[model samples]
Target: MAQQQWYKGAVIYQVYPRSFQDSNNDGIGDLKGIINRIDYIKSLGVDAIWISPFFKSPMKDFGYDISDYRDIDPLFGDLNDFDTLIEQAHARDIKIIIDQVLSHTSDQHQWFLDSRENTSNDKADWYVWAEAKQDGSAPNNWLSIFGGPAWQWEPRRGQYYLHNFLTEQPDLNFHNPDVRQAVLDNVEFWLKKGVDGFRLDAINFCYHDAQLRDNPAKPKDKRQGRGFSEDNPYAFQYHYYNNTQPENIEFMRDIRALLNQYPGTVSLGEISSEDSLATMAEYTEGGDKLHMGYSFELLTDDYSSEYIRTTVETLEQRMTEGWPCWAFSNHDVERVASRWSDNGEINPTQCKMLTALLASLRGSVCMYQGEELGLGEADVAFEDLQDPYGITFWPNFKGRDGCRTPMPWDDQHAQYAGFSSHKPWLPVDMAHKAQSVALQDADEHSILNAYREFMAWRKTHTILLEGDIEFIATAEPILAFYRTLGEQKMLCVFNLGATTASMPLPLSVVTEHNELSHHTGSVNQQLLTLPAFGCFYAQC
Candidate 1:
């Protein structure tokens, strides 16, 4: 494989900096902490580590609201610390993929500050600003994903500026060529830092409709998914005009052009649109855009054989040329261990099955921190919640804080679970201590060990890495698929239930069973019986 295409079929480990580890005992994870843990990340057998945004920010929406794109925030240490992290991680053959939030910037950003100063400032057209209507309402009916109106009134400009997220985060006006160039310039700044790739956060929201049109309303039943609860007015609309604009295609090409200049670097877009699967397909098509794209389709509460099959098939059908990346948990959603569980419980066997299924799919995969340990979502109380989104929706929607807690390093540590000497920003889940890396390292059957073994095994099978996928017809709780690469074929079957599942197979017996596979299934008389959450892999 070409060095530039290393991302294809690669496994990326996502490290949420604030929660990963703290090196300075300051209660917040820093770049030096990541540098200290390079061996742990490398041991997981991931090709790259996609660190969430640690850029300079006012912390309104955490690091997503970047005030300075090229500089590291003091809370996460200085740029020198980041450089050391890059050097250490690269030494371990691990690529560093940083999160790049391109759609918007913190209201405190110099560009937005200058733009809001006057109508004719040098950066006046940098952000999306519009004049209010005669009634003095918002420019249009577009809504912010966080809640309320998408338009934030700026007294300085005497006009409303569009904010697709928190009001403090003003959307950038990609319609202006200068704004686009400046964004690319910031991206180039990172490229010069020896980074391998970028996880483009909310990349689809870069451009909006120039006409400032109102988004069409959706039926009450359709106002679901994409992490928005029914109570959030942002879900009431189809979100057509506010994002996924046609102009974004050209911007994607520009990003691709810039990336083309740097070989061995790639772009993986995080797309959440009205039709995210279709948008994922569109943004990554023709090899002139994103190298790979992933959406929230699998991060949802729905988990079943049919749901998994259909989601992958739909994307596979629409995405012919570009690659896909799959993730079950991330900084934005609840942990998959709890989200997919029957009664909000964590099952180690089920997690192993999920990893096998995810890694066996057609494309690359993203493993969030703590996922290998089978960590469940933390139940943060209302008072402990730090996310503004959770604070807004309250009881009905507790927001993302449940999933953003600090990582537990040692179970014996009295306070902060060895994540920090001081009280961390968010409380570490106490239940996770038993599943800490130190504890799991000694248990051969632990989820962490299983993940390491499976990843190491997966690297040996090129068929599992670069093969075409075809689903096998199976009943509920049983998902079967065949991965074919040239003349090599591997049949992957999974039992996704909490009980033993039996199904008829076409073959009477499986002659070859790889010892490295985590299989608890048996094939006899053309009947396949799998233990709860068991998986079977064999040459077909």
Candidate 2:
């Protein structure tokens, strides 16, 4: 038998550090806060915790626009506090996977500060710098994912610098060997600190077209791309020349070489390009690149079983030798419960069903914070909103602030769902209070407990984690698939609709797990019936 990799069957929990937990009675969550909750995360049975960026940042794009890669921001705590967190988490047997925003740096970063000063500086080539056209407009038609043009002209340097997101987040020029080495060195720093892996943020946007070519217009049907808004002008471009450069392959090799030295460490890239799925496939096509890559394909509003099956199958077919990571919710998009709901209301049954469905998939899994409690998008009003993207595209898009709210821990703790004694950075969704961790802990049937039970149960099924998946042909609302690894196989079925569904079965049940099966589900000989938002797991 081939030796198994630790991450192959691992489950990752993503935490937006600023909103996870707050210690020292501060309004914002800090590293100490995360340290206090280490035991709570340990109870989830997740293998690793992918903490979002807590590095030194001005909070322009939250921690995504990092000013320093090596230091922890004061709002999150100091380096010493983070060291304690790593120590405590390691003690609990939880691996740490930090969020690495390598594509861009905060405009305030010393590298960018020096690069923007003069074209002759040693750091001038560290960022994408281009001369403006004769009309004095942007060099090309590239637009920022936030709202306006991708190019920001620096008066001091007399050249436009590229920023795929907000102007404060300037794109890094990976074409510069020095820039690539610096990124690798920073990554190595974390590996030496005992981090198990890295979640590379916007990995494909590290390099852009050297010719400064204008992007062609995108077809009308293809509007949405990662963080770009439907109303934003950025949706009009195909984003071909601006990102997903071929040089990224070589850079990935360099990153992989560094990680291989750490032994057992892994790299998962977040790809956002014109053809993000294709980019994901290409980036992980060879073992030298990313160990796994996840795209925004499954994060959208599409919830039909057909769409889910097609997306996974398509990626599987396209990937020659790549492993894929699937996530339905993250800090960026709306909660999957709200986005995938049928009638615009949060259904706990549907929530439980999706949890089982996501876990039963073939690849590694990632569950966002508060998702275990079946929390939906927090309704942040205009006055309570903090996301710049939502603020820019108000009325049309409310921004990601709704999904970035603090996790509701307890109603009895304080005003902000036990997150902090002071006012929170973002408003807590009052609706989440009822489903808080304290309340759900006592209820065996609660989504919180269900997630725990399902995850614990899934660990026994090695086939479900590392097996090859083949989608079973079925009608709408009913998604069925078989996870097979040689003689070990498990047939998983889920009804994603509001109404009951039934289909004929071809496999016989060897053992049935009662804990995970919804009471509304049944299988008799050749017939299978499932209630609305029901599921059945049978070993064949």
Candidate 3:
């Protein structure tokens, strides 16, 4: 296998800070709490940990909207705590990749606050602002992902500022050289502090149409949810002019140049565009932009083998040198087990099989916290909802709070699963408690143990990491593929359905075989039987 950067096929574990651990009994997870868990995280065999933003923010978007890119949020702990966390993580051979919100900043940010003061201030043009139309309405018909108009009028500046998300999180003007340089400087600041890489948030939304052209209306039939409910007006537009502009390529080059300065430093852009897959390819193309990019392609409730095959194949065909990171769960969406579970019941064996399947995939893999325990979504009451998105579009859509609940480390009966002394930011479901890390730790056949075993096995196989992937077409339910490198080849088969499935192997090409069932010993045969959610990894 050819040698490349560590992140190329690395397993990145995402830690949603607030839900991970609480150190000071404040009920919110802090840096010290994360530091305390380094050994546990390292035990899982992940190469790196991608932390969700913990920068000072108003929590309007739960740290996605940043007030200070350099400092840690008081709720999460101070800079000293963050420094210790970084030192501990590195000591365990775990790289730290932080979320960088470059496209926008919290309105409380010093730059935005000054910009809002008046049009004459030096920072007035730092954010995207425009004069109100003759009718005293928003400058355009663009709508925010959160709700109404994307443009919010600032009385002090007498101009409408653009915010694709909440109004409090104003969009930065990437067209301005100074703005671009400032964001890059912030990135350098993290690099100086020993960060390995970044997960760029809303990367495709960095720039807009210079002429301020209105986005064309999308056809009613063509309209899909813009990471929001279909009922939200944000789905009405095609969003062509508002984001994913052609100019984004130049900006990515600038960012890549900075990353190139630090050896082993990589970037994974979160492309949130209407054409996310296409944008993903664009962002990572030619190896001069983002090192890798991921879209919401696998984050949805859809759990069909056909959907998975098509998404990967399409990106493979379009992607030249670009790489993609695949994730089934994150802070923004419901847990995959709960989302994909039929009628809300998931078999533990099936969860183990799924973990093996994800680890065997071609691209870099991202595992959300608590996913290894086969944790499902928590049912939160409307009265206790803290997510603005869920609160705004209640009844039809419960926001991301369900998945953002705290990690259960102890037994279902323990208080707060031993997470904190105080109440958590969100309630932990009784059902999820049974799948806590402590419970799984004791069970040899638990999903957490399966994850550990599969990840450890994966690290020994270069073919599973950087190999070329070729799909083995089957009728239905059975998804099979082969990963081939120089002279090594491995076959991976997964049963994506609830029933037992069987498939015939290509015996002509398979001269030798060894199965990694995890639950059982090797099964080297022409015909394979897969129980519900069974996965088989073998060498030929």
Q: What TM-scores do the predictions have?
A: 0.98, 0.97, 0.97
Q: Candidates 2 and 3: which is better by lDDT?
A: 2
- List residue ranges in candidate 2 displaced over 4 A: 1-4, 507-513, 517-520
Backbone clash pairs for candidate 3 read none
Candidate order by TM-score, decreasing, is 1, 2, 3
lDDT string, candidate 3, 1-540, tens digits: 222488877899999999999999998998888998899999999999999999999899899989999998899999898789889998998999999999999999999999999988899889999999899998888889898989998899888999999989999999999999999999999998888899998899999888988888889998776356778888888999889999999999999999889878889999878888889998898878999998888887678888888888888888868888998888888888888786688677777777777777778988999888888888999998999999998988888899988899889888999788799998878787888889889988788988998888788888888898888888678888999999888888888788878888776544334444443222457777777777777677
lDDT of 3: 0.86
* Per-residue alpha-carbon lDDT of candidate 2 for residues 1-540, written as tens digits (9 for 90 to 100): 122277886789998988999897778988888888888898888988999999999998899999999999889988889789889988987888999999899999999999999989999999999888899988888888898899898999999999999999999898899999998999998998989899999898888989988899988897865655677888888888888989888998898889989888888999888777788899987788889998788898888899999989998888869888899999899999899989878898888888888878878888999989899998999999888999999999999999999888986445898999889999888888888998998898898888888888888878877899999999998999999999987888889889989988875765474656443587777788899998887778
* Of 1 and 2, the candidate ranking higher by TM-score: 1
> lDDT of each prediction vs. the true structure?
0.91, 0.87, 0.86
The candidates, ranked best first by lDDT, are 1, 2, 3
Model 2 compared with the native: what TM-score?
Answer: 0.97
Q: Which window of ten consecutive residues has the lowest lDDT sum in model 3? A: 514-523
Candidate 1 lDDT: 0.91
Off by over 4 Å in 3: 1-4, 509-525
| Model 1 CA deviation exceeding 4 Å by range | 508-511
Q: Top lDDT: which candidate number?
A: 1
